[model samples]
Target chain A: MKANEVPQDKSSLDSINQKELCYATDESGNYITTKSSGWTPKTIALNNAIEDIKERAEEAKQRVLNNETSPIEYYMELNRMDVTILAGYVGIWPFRVKRHFNPKRFKKLSDKLLQKYADAFNISLKQLKQGDLNED
Target chain B: MKIDFKHHQSAHCENGVVSNLMKHNGLNISEPMIFGIGSGLIYCYIPFLKVNHGPAVTYRVMPGLIFKRFAKRIGVTFKREKFKSVAKAKQRLDENLKNNNPVGLQVGIYHLLYLPDHYRFHFNAHNIVVYGKEGNNYLVSDPVIETVATLDEKQMEKARFAKGPFAPNGQIYYPISFPKESDIPYKEAIVKGIKQTCRDMLAPIPIVGVKGIRMVAKLIKKWPKKKGIKVANHYLGQIVRMQEEIGTGGGGFRYIFAAFLQESSAILNNEKLMELSKEMTVIGDLWRDFALEASRLYKNRKATTGSYDKVSEMLFELADKEEVFFKTLKKAIK
Candidate 1:
């Protein structure tokens, strides 16, 4: 909480192109604005969250390769979504979506259903079927 | 059609947008001051209300209220609208920009391109300013980001219409007229802001204010036995996320409140407020410690259930300190 504790070295703060500015009091109790140094404890906590999501995405991707689930499942994981959320976006029942997680069932989905999934994930049907995970 | 708007990054969205908008309208005010005057601090934990499949725990008031309250207190007239159609919303925003008026918008964070992937969630109360339009992109000033950024028009429309809890229905606001800076009453506004904050912190509601902190402490203490370690840890993780990750300006909003207190001290020439500000900073540090301890328990799988008890005890102590702090603050201003 001391001013010195806030890393004065600009390079440490620039690890990421963090645009958010934090307003905190200095050692002399003067308020000043500064960018996050990425080394801050809060930043570390945020990094942990990002890492957890990435790990989930990776696990979901491996499941797709093994044919244990459909590509929709992988996209759901990549978007930090659960069946309830994905179903909400696609306007379907969670139970029905669970059935569609099977690759066979997903392949048989109507264009309407597939289009809904693609729209919810913000991707094209081609990309959805092919398991494209790249950011748009 | 770029309006001459200066964007400054802020610790939180609503306060940042309000501060920037006020500055653009020729009224200069610090973000913390705006936050305080608007009575933005809050503590609410609802077990039934689920956000992203967890109990809803919020550290501040609902979005857009701060802008409303600050404007009211400062005697600034402003216009607010929420369009039923996205196309209509886009047209209005474009017209405002064409006329050189910077407009404030409330959009979901999930679709914002400038945010880091990790930070984007389904949170729909994020605030930003659309100051101009350049071809297919809208030049935006999002307070959480370091600099002004641009968003594709189609993407901005989608973000505006994002569905979920607190979905912004293409909401936009802008100041129409502001009172002269010299005519504003700083001391009176600061006093009123302080009193309202004290009331919010000390209110007797079990699910909000100081009592809400106690309720969370109680839940943390019993979570492992009732919900099991996995569920308890998940809930604790959510708490840390609300406190540290969701643009809380650190320690929930305690740090920002402390900064407000420091400014109040200088304006009122009260050394006691300065002392209280430092004390509040210490309290903020304790909250940070609580977050660190909770996160440590979450990361370590081998951690025993007793670790949950330790964190709960810390919360109880924090609640006690804050209770006394607010009580003293209420009397100090009188």
Candidate 2:
């Protein structure tokens, strides 16, 4: 099935969108208060995509942990893929400093980038050096 | 005490050792803080040229045992600025020597880092010594050997240490102004470079994924509990500050990682993991634009903390996406 074609729960996705900010709920996600009975094709579809990315990232990360590739190279590859997805968010709106720099989302992006590197390298940010050795 | 060697123009003598010739003269030598750490070179000044002697002057190349190649790069030139305005240095030299009563000529000591061959780095000391002056043409001492080992006798012999009361090449006339306590300008430059380089490496950026998540988990767990949140907070600040200072996106992250790895867990704590990761993500998203903005601004105006509002927006987006994606997992666990 195509990515967007996959079914998802419209109400669940909408519930999150309605919130001013995603992390605003802190420990509880928006749907946490809802009953667990709300399983739908749309929900499943979104979960699958999320799972796919997670799995792909995991496999790639394992290769790095196993010493197959460098962290920088891997991140670049992810950026290449994500850039297409991110283009709309970045390029769709009128050009403005505020629109361009979404501090909350930027933090997530930064964390994701670092997470990719650290995962692939099997290291903490603290442990990584300019040339940390990894086994392939 | 000025020893000038006349060699063919084509013959390359070690300037590292040649710098010592200034010491043969009455000038006091001060240790070079920067150049002394690795292989060192001797820089010398010649007052006159001898027709029979090969070159007008020569330089001594003192290579450190570990970094021999660096020792070979030291070269000699006629630049007068290399000498602390002789009259000024002389006055200080005279006063210091009067109290210390050095054995011989006073020379300036310098520390230099050089790369002679591929993949090899070296550090050594450079000093100024005088040789001889004849009719406006002073026969200055020159570096005869290419590289020397260490201050020890065995290494000294390998570098062809000549027999003399002076330390290997020449004796310290007056206590060379060692950089130990004085506010020497060159020392400050070297220290700045070293500190900056290290600081740049230790800042943070973001990485994503399960393995990354797992690693962070491991890190958080392993992080020492004794230290307050300050340790983690320091790394977080380092990441942000370095991005601001280096203006090269997230250049400081590697150094931060290096420090984290190098230091004992007793110093780092769990709070650092969450704080650092959060900060890293925020900075990474904005790094490219931020760096560009910083580049456009005057060096003085480029505040490190530029546009936190934008960073805040990015963080919220990330939180939303993560919440959307991870809610299921958290719910299932709940």
Candidate 3:
């Protein structure tokens, strides 16, 4: 795409503070090095990813409020994790973790399992059980 | 204990780190030039390997290969180590910094505190330089960021020990000896780099290089029928992310390679290379077009204005263009 046709999303452009240098060919096909104002397509991809994560976190919060799943499930989604990754972190089988997604099963989880989860998430057991969503 | 290291931002991590490290050792080379000499560009799609739950599509070679290849090509000796213990790794890094040596590190992006939250992912191949240490934070020169940043001790350790595919394992590297700038055979290295890149693009491997592009195009054609619209779109998005999001210099390293050609043209005093460089920029634009269209399909979700076939055809055209370009480049450089 032509440089003029490059996306000019001001909000995303303003998000970058560092003013990194980038190399690009000018309109006359001359190579030039210029400070990036963050109009690159990569910035747009990053914005999309952030929006997706936020939406997932919001949906996960709703799921926890409705008691459709346990807080563990909510935290997993908040961390951008699936059952496979959470299981790997917690040293449990993915199938078992899927079962733990049910509030009834999560409540019955032993202290050992809860501690494992807390450690995996770098949080305390109390915080894990309470489902605190605050970033540390 | 700060070392006098100048950090220059780059389009890709490894290339940037390599370029900056070389310059710090008194060898001035542009990031794209290092990328070209290292033969960093590549195209591969693996169905079984998954990144973010979609098939893995990579635009460059694996991490550390660039540094390794570039150093070897220029006869520079370097040292690389992977620690079994984080504390040992920290000690070594500190020792290097104390001696005024800037050290390169392979760390996971997720735990890199300096990156914006939106940009952090589980990618573990991210490269940075740790040049000094304060009370509790290490002075970091992350090549992608605007300025040199700092990472706390705990966060640095976390990033170094981040577990997953391609974990860093506290990997660190630094130059042991530097060759004089006059010792580098720039023209010969440029020719070899160009030839190797051509081979990569024209290789017969169906799952790699230009053929890999065609293979992915064919897979894109089949995705909707076999995996349904949502899954197909997800895979397509992953491909675009690999091309555009991941430090690919805005078109799967095409622009960077074009820039490399431009610099090499001047170095070798070859007008033919200058013309080839312009052609490369055009190819980079085409790749961007492919990314834009694929991203549109990914966002549509409804399959309204975009289709898998259309995206695949676009990729096929790109593959054809790249094939012709590489063939011509091989003859021109020879």
Q: Best candidate per TM-score, number?
A: 3
Error of 1 at B57 (Å): 1.8
Scoring only the second chain, what is candidate 3's TM-score? 0.97
DockQ of each: 0.35, 0.01, 0.36
Better of 1 and 3 by lDDT: 1
Better TM-score candidate (2, 3): 3
Candidate 1 similarity to native, TM-score: 0.88
Quote the lDDT for A31 in model 1: 74
Candidate 3, CAPRI quality class derived from DockQ: acceptable
Q: Candidate 2 residues B115-183, lDDT tens each?
A: 111101011122322223333332322231122211222221211212111112322232233332233
**TM-score for candidate 3:** 0.89
Which pairs, if any, clash in model 3?
Answer: none
For all predictions, the C-alpha RMSD in Å is 3.2, 29.5, 3.0
Model 2 residue runs over 4 Å out of place are A1-136, B1-285, B292-334
Ten contiguous residues with the weakest lDDT in model 3 chain B: B243-252
**Candidate order by decreasing lDDT:** 1, 3, 2
Better of 1 and 3 by DockQ: 3
Which ranges in model 3 have alpha carbons more than 4 Å from their true place?
Answer: A1-8, A11-13, A40-44, A51-73, A82-116, A130-136, B246-252
lDDT of 3 by residue, B76-106 (tens): 8989999988789989998999899999999
| TM score of chain A per candidate | 0.71, 0.34, 0.71
